[model samples]
Target: MVDDRDLLKVVSGIIGEERTSDDCCMIKVGDDNIILSTDMLHESTDFPRGMTDWQIGWMSAAVTLSDVASCGAVPLALLLAAGLDEPERISGITAGAKDCCERFGAELAGGDIDFHSELTIVTTGIGRVEDEYYKTRRGAKPGDIVCVTGTPGCAGAALEGSERYWKNLVEPLPAVREGRLLAVAGVSSMMDVSDGIALSLYDLSGSSCVGFEISMDNLPLSPGVSPEMALYSGGDFGLLFTCGRDILPVTGVDCTVIGVVTDSGEVLCDGVLVERRGYSHRWMEEI
Candidate 1:
């Protein structure tokens, strides 16, 4: 079976590696750089059961904005394209998207609507950041400290029937403010931990050419969340970053240093090999 990352190789080949390497594409616009990102979600896959139309809409927008935040950009606008199974779903979806945008200091500029067999949404975000302030996934150095914002596996716990984390699953908030703060603090590299910490560490290792040594004891797991779940569960939209010790005590963001970067390209947790498995769409080979 081939996973989504394997398919990304095809996209990288077609669009050029430089373009597909980062969370968002950077384009210079006068004094600031415009960062753009897009995400797609479907009713059957992305949204969980019992989620309201409004929550679905918010999730669709939040995912893309999380991408923009990973780039250390200030979100300016969002464009949503909704494909609804029922026409009435459009109003609630639009309202939810708009409210999310407004909450994060962005506007829901425009979008497209259409009928489809199932509900689907595609959101595109536009953001701006000064060239010096924009961050990427390719700058970690050996000895840099590894950190993550917010407790991971909360959404996964919610999925496991923990009502305490329901909001974290349904209306996950992006780390836009924290990303900017980390960028200003001159962090080496940054990315969102939407695909679980283990996979995210591998992605960062590949990008930055460095490995990570994480301590299972240091991971800030949500209450009652197991270490295995914290490592592999997805939908936690927190930021994973690397930086030097000199930048400690980054104000205004609740982040925990869980590990350190290593020059050897091997990811380890508690001195054992961390598996490369997470929330990814996989396809089996045809017979």
Candidate 2:
């Protein structure tokens, strides 16, 4: 195992921040502060050998940006850490990263370049929100309503019936606006879905120590996506949350209530606990 401590030590040193913020970090500078997150994409690890360079750049931004969204923070700037076999490929990578940043009202702050045989992208994202709106993976309470932003299984729908990806899912609505919508509406403890519903929900459950119950029938589905796949697939890039039960106001993409929080340490849907553990990078194919 690479271990979280060593990884954090190296990342904190390289990024110039000696502190660890757990899932999300905050620094106070008088009245204003900032939140930071970094994600890495390696050609040998993330991309298949025959993947297209154009999609590589776009996918890089999408994956990294998802982390920022998961923190329930609005992105402000993005920095690229790139290594490439072909220098010309940097342009495409930048363009893609820039496109994603621009879509979410974020800036392409700066980047580093290195020469290598395989392409890799490392993104450092900066985001901010008022002190009152720093949503994280915690704070969920018992009886809170569990909702998911937008339709699920977007990438799954794109790869329907095919185990391996052939094309990227259609670019969905950026979660920035959705976060803004939820923040202003006074919702907290939100995260964007990346590791599939069951896994991500399990994370929220563990973080809050409150079990969850989701109604399989109410789980939102994208066109042509299966319920199981939609529920357990990643790249949905949507928000999944457990909010107070006052019918609180929310904005941006539509959300569907899948379940509620419970006292037990288990998740149930339609009278059954989720049998599969859901998707993880280490078990995508197996899931």
On lDDT, the leading prediction is 1
**Pairs with steric clashes in candidate 1:** none
Which digits, one per residue and each the tens of the lDDT, describe model 1 over residues 1-287?
Answer: 88888888889999998887787999977777899999889998899999998998888889999999998899999999999899999888998899899888889999999999988899999999887778888999999999999999999888889899999999999998998999988899999989999999999999999999999999998778988878888999999999999997899989999999999999999899899988888889721
Listed per candidate, the RMSD to the true structure in angstroms reads 1.2, 4.6
In order, candidate lDDTs are 0.91, 0.71
Instruction: State, as a TM-score between 0 and 1, how close model 1 is to the true structure.
Output: 0.98
Residue 248, candidate 2: alpha-carbon lDDT: 59
Poorly placed runs, candidate 2 (over 4 Å): 1-23, 48-51, 160-173, 283-287
**Residue 55, model 1: Cα distance from true site in angstroms:** 0.6
In model 2, the Cα lDDT at residue 137 comes to 72
Off by over 4 Å in 1: none
Tens-digit lDDT string for candidate 2 (173-257): 4577776677656664777776678877777776677888888889887556678877887756778877787755564447888
> Cα deviation of 242 in candidate 2 (Å)?
1.4
